[model samples]
Target: MTAPAELDAAGITDPALRAAYTTCRELNARHGRTYFLATRLLPRERRPAVHALYGFARYADEIVDDLGDGRPVVEKAARLDALALELDRALDGALDRAVPGGAMGHPVLAALADTARRYDIDTRYFRDFLVSMRMDTTVTDYATFEDLAVYVHGSAAVIGLQMLPVLGTTVPRADAEPAAAALGEAFQITNFLRDVGEDLDRGRVYLPAAELAAFGVDRQLLTWCRRTRRPDPRVRRALAHLVAHTRAIYRRAAPGVGMLEPASRACVSCAFALYRGILDEIEAADHHVLHRRVTVPARRRAAVALPCLARAIVARTRG
Candidate 1:
């Protein structure tokens, strides 16, 4: 369905609200390539909410990462704080009041607050996400996966929790929560591996310091590899280990596809396949992710998505 048709199907009639959702959909379409492809397989009415969620995430990530704008860390932190305050006010019914140039004035926040209200999504999950976004301005590296898990719980895991309400579930929501969160962690870990070079350029190292240390890899070695656009055996070994670790996460997350509502299962399953396929691409390149990003080819993406799209149509027909 087209964007306007999606808004109509979702019962979103207000002009400003539709505009807000449209802005979010644009962000998702432009930035979240694989994710946006998966979302297309969802029922049209549900697509706007998923777009809102991803839009909010991508906005916050841009603020923290600055997307090569060379903004000062203090400026980014201030922006993040302002966003958190705005989000808090937005969640507290400020948007319904429609105060001039307030929380509702921001398109991404406007859409997100609407989604949160509609789904009764917990406020704490959004709060936790901001806390992690705040961490990016200060924390540079994690000592171990345990320490990284603290960051991931806020950065990644809560995203899945936020999504559960919108996606619906076959079992109790709580019953499916673990795998949902695991899937989020897996996706983020894959990103960390794929973007290691870019993240290093941004002065952050997401991989666990201890894990790299075990393979005699450190920020210096990674930076050297990124600078020279070359790969080291030790660096390749470290990436190989992390890729295996990420595959285990994908395994842990696999069963949750069954836990989703049938109509939603195909969308999540397609995303699962595509994101996991990044691991395959990385491995196929012999884990040479230090100097460049790895991606699933467009042909491979189409091959995975077509079958799932057909499945989604059948599931919706049955429902």
Candidate 2:
């Protein structure tokens, strides 16, 4: 990780900059409370940088994904792309010099530029993330696993790549990076499975029509609210296979738990197990996603975290 030759104005210690940092902290705590809670368990030095990374990622994601009007998608993407470039300049230490001439600060970017330096997070990931955001703006369905993976790569995998530096790992040690990417894919695929009806209403079918046809399940039953399961053997037959695909991805995400630093392992472990548990719930319900979205309760989240937490604690004690 390289340090900047000179500090950007974003991190200048003037009273106004200090106040902005305070505001950023409060805003992140407000909107990112859950991620903040998880980060609190990490080593103290790692927490702020990680929170900042998550804060920026979540903010960028909210843009194209805003879902209110198509208008926000275009506006947010432009802002995000510009913000990404500003971050890059701060990283290079050559630009982002806050001109001598009067200039207004972008509130979020002001804080994020310092966070990038503090953690050595790469600039490219932030840039690539928007390309993924563009996909969300235009592409919403999956025809093949290849296409699905491409979408996941831009949306989720790059996020893991961004976080890698904050965890204090080198690119070579970045071997664990792939596992992190897989874990994110697990999170995304679960979201898609759970949101099938919602996505379909927007004229998207995450579960391919071709694959559904294999089961004799028509689009109306899958997209409409009437039936959660099928009376036909072909539908039943196809769903069993679909459920397994969900399970397989969860299994793929499991090994990544150990890939995270021990202090950060608990949250990922809980998420992984809870998502797998949801898959089990889907199986138990016979894949009836329409009646309700499957969820692992708070109790279950705590229960899943216990084992990983204990393991992390024990490892620290020995060390």
Cα-based lDDT for every prediction? 0.91, 0.59
Residues 207-306, candidate 2: write the lDDT tens digits.
Answer: 6556677777766766544244434455445666766776776676576666666666665555566666766666676666654666666676677666
- lDDT of model number 1: 0.91
| Candidate 1: residue pairs that collide | none
Pairs of colliding residues, candidate 2: none
Can you tell me which runs of candidate 1 are displaced by over 4 Å? 67-69, 94-103
Q: List, residue by residue over 12-69, the lDDT tens digit for candidate 1.
A: 8878889999999999999999999999999999999999999999999999875624
Q: What is the C-alpha RMSD of each candidate to the true structure, in Å?
A: 2.0, 6.1
Positional deviation of residue 219's Cα in model 1 after best superposition, in angstroms: 0.6
